[model samples]
Target: MFNQLISFLDKGKIRKIARSHRAERYVKKFSTYNHVVVMLFTVFEGYHSIREIVLGLLANAHKLQHLGINYVVKRSTLSEANERRISTVFEEIYQDVYNRHQRAFSGQPFKQ
Candidate 1:
């Protein structure tokens, strides 16, 4: 189910956006893609805190592999990524998705 929902996201486009924003600069193990995946997981699972998000991911480690999440995200890692990464990258992605599906949403084409 999670995998299916993430299928709507274009990984190539995500990487492109990350590059444009330099979101991966100085990054080590955690990439922008991983960050995005972890955030989506947190929201979908209704995790109220960073501790719960970490534990939840750790608990479902085996299942998350199919989602391309290989390592368990540490609380610090998630917190730091949320702070350092440019929020505009996500805004651009959201706008892209919204524009692409705006007609379906409003029954009319989106205006620029």
Candidate 2:
């Protein structure tokens, strides 16, 4: 969801996604790695694909900004970004979330 992205991007470096001089495409710096970052996040969060994410946005299309992306990202683009970018960093971020949860609950476990 684009609304969720507002918070997610705010708390993450995706706010700094890079674009090439030759193209309007927003290429996350690690290339294929970036694809994996998005793919994994979507999957882990229970989304099936970029299409699902895009469909979510389309449902709330009136609220989305002028992204110039009128359609779902092609599977090829998804595959290419996954193949070309550095996704391990994203996996680490996901792992860190689990680690933080562990720490929060293991020692001074919340009273609730």
- lDDT for 30 in candidate 2 is 27
Query: Each candidate's TM vs. the true structure?
Result: 0.86, 0.38
In Å, residue 87's CA in model 2 sits off its true spot by 2.6
lDDT of each: 0.84, 0.44
Give residue 41's lDDT in candidate 1 (0 to 100).
89
**Which parts of model 2 are misplaced by more than 4 Å?**
1-6, 15-41, 49-71, 92-112
Which residue pairs collide, candidate 1? none
Winning model by lDDT:
1
Model 2: pairs clashing at backbone N, Cα or C within 3 Å:
30-85, 30-86, 31-85, 32-81, 32-82, 32-84, 32-85, 33-85, 33-86, 33-87
Steric collisions counted per model: 0, 10
Tens digits of per-residue lDDT, candidate 1, 1-112, equal 7887677677788889899999988889888888888888888999999999999998999887888888998888889988999899888776776766665565666556
